[model samples]
Target chain A: MQVVVPFAAETPKTRLRSVLSAAERSRFARAMLADVLEALARTGHDLTVVATSPLSSDDDLVGVPSTVRVEVDDRPLTDAVDARLPRRGRTGEPVAVVMADLALATPESLEGLFGPDADVVIAPGRGGGTNALVVRHPDFRADYHGASYLDHRAAANGVGASLETIDSFRLGTDIDEPADLVEVLIHGTGRSPECLRALGFELERTDGRVDTERSLDSTSADSRSR
Target chain B: MQVVVPFAAETPKTRLRSVLSAAERSRFARAMLADVLEALARTGHDLTVVATSPLSSDDDLVGVPSTVRVEVDDRPLTDAVDARLPRRGRTGEPVAVVMADLALATPESLEGLFGPDADVVIAPGRGGGTNALVVRHPDFRADYHGASYLDHRAAANGVGASLETIDSFRLGTDIDEPADLVEVLIHGTGRSPECLRALGFELERTDGRVDTERSLDSTSADSRSR
Candidate 1:
């Protein structure tokens, strides 16, 4: 089985711009990518990172294992992954596409996406996004758009593919919003959380839910470093 | 400075009957209640457990500290808690009401509910249920019916009480359904997970999500023991 991780290297995670600066967003994106890659690597799967632009430096790929392949695609996510997906009955091999920002993803959580029970396995995010997927049938291609999970289900049905939806909290939780960073602090076990903590992000309870708060002392030092 | 934990001892967790037997549900509910009580006791609050009926035996109170007081109140939840709520300007003491099924509650998570910023602090459950709350105003009382979190907000507004909502995953997560058992196994720190594991519950990936599966060996043995 081969796994492809789609990363937005250029202007990544704009939703988190309110909380993370450009440099911090870049670093955090890479950190989440590293976490995803680590989980995929542990699964002993053939890993390929399809980034929108070239990784800036070795720092951008710090925790990613050397065995994994990194490809600079520059194209949109749907197009990049669609081109790589093998058609059903062509190669008859399973292909998985895992988002780079699944900060809470673990090998155990990723195991569900690799099972051969279905020709298409989709892991839906909290707000109707397709976080991760496995395509066993070559007929099914990627469709990354607004409410992509619904579109993917339609596509799979259109292709007559046997589809299964994974309801995993870890795989479904992508690091996009400032509120999501709290989940990383609570349940994460990788460099993504380390990066957040190093940037002084801490969990605080407010507004009837848990949210992240950066330390004031670290905020000043972080600005100085930047 | 006072905390009330409401419990339904007679027919606890009827929603979980599909997965857990009567005996198992009773044991699991007690385990979750114990977890909540442990977290509350750690906060050093004046703890009162308002049960619908008397506790079966000392076994039902295992893992709960002796400092906590148990009271028998065979009324509906809303009526039971409302009866205990101190009216504004009377005692002028803050009172907290925490659900007995908050298997994920911790001292840290409960801290947010006790903050003095608001006259009423509510921690809404995942599905708009009021999981826990603190009342500093004498006029405000609980209404634990449908969408009680929203109703509590309205009730607080009706009384012109300054309200704050504590956004805590730990406090918000209440163990009710069989599917909720997976969360206890994942992030729980108390005897609830132990109780589940002892019943041979284990996490397994299926249909793209992690779910609990009780072992066949344990199932037969559990039935035999019952």
Candidate 2:
């Protein structure tokens, strides 16, 4: 299966401002990207990183394998995905879109995603967003906006494409808000959490909410590491 | 308005089994009940704690004032709420069903709730359950089950009860699972979090998810307090 990860590169993870500075948000976004890429790379599929902007010189993709390709597109998510997919490809293979912020996504979920032999296979996010989806039919294109899952289903029905939905908790959880950091730290054990911990961020009870805060003890103890 | 809290006292907070033991679950449930009761009591409305079983003599409702009444009922949640509402009470006054786990619910939210002159007003939980609802029309009743919010809306429509939904984050935060505890710690300053902290519970990032764990440092450092 040909996989494409629609990543917002230049202006990443603005919703995380409550717990992270702009630089920290960028760093955490990259870390999440690295984690998602590593997971996708392990599946041994031909993948592409469709970024919103040109990659910087210092912004290296650490865990991404050489098998993955990179493309830059400045359009919205739906347009970006639509622009990438071919109406008719070599041997008529299927294309799948995986979100880069899905830090908990595993190879097992990806395996299940491709197992369904439908013209269109969708994985919906918890908050009404289309998280990951696979399209085999040429006429089927993604519409990734508010409640895009429904829009995609309509498009599939209009094109007479058989549709299937993949149920995955890990895939369903998308890191979009400050509250979502708790989900990443709890359900993941990868580059993202490691990066946060490295930056002295620890899960602490802030007032009454579970939040990420800089651990003063860690900062002093690991001053030399910085 | 008559406020009826449909509480599952016997099987309280079984969903919290992931992090808390059975005894801890009961204690935490009671603390949440107390918090809800306290919030409701502040509204100066005649309130009743409709219990699934006998509220234990030792179940000292710490913050619950004297105005609240406790009644034992073994029926289902929907039935317990129905049985408690007076047929022809003071000036055909409306009745409300408030879930006891809404620890973050405030007096202001309750004020806004009663202020609305509607046949049926609902405050929906994050996970689709009806957290708190006010039923003015005597013909209207409650259906507290999976996606009860939808059920309530349908019921309201069926009976021609003008439906109103309260949009408050505080009213929506109902503690149901281990992850829900993080919400309690972050959004509320009630007996629930206090009891959890008193029990040595603290927010910790286990693997990658936000989780409640006993503070080992507190156990040693503040041994005398315990």
By summed lDDT, the worst window of 10 consecutive residues in model 2 chain B runs over B217-226
Mark the regions of model 2 whose C-alpha exceeds 4 Å error after superposition.
A56-58, A86-91, A205-211, A216-226, B1-51, B54-226
Clashing pairs in 2: A185-B208, A185-B209, A186-B208, A186-B209, A187-B208, A187-B209, A208-B185, A208-B186, A209-B185, A209-B186
User: On residues B31-82, what C-alpha lDDT tens digit does candidate 1 reach at each position?
Assistant: 9999999898888899999998998598788988889898999988889998
The list of candidate 1 runs beyond 4 A from truth reads: A1-226, B220-226
DockQ of 2: 0.03
DockQ each candidate and list the results: 0.03, 0.03
**lDDT for position A25 in model 1:** 89
* Candidate 2 local lDDT, A69-125, one digit each (tens): 888898988899987665865457788899999887777767877789999998766
> Which candidate's TM-score is highest?
1
Error of 1 at B18 (Å): 0.9
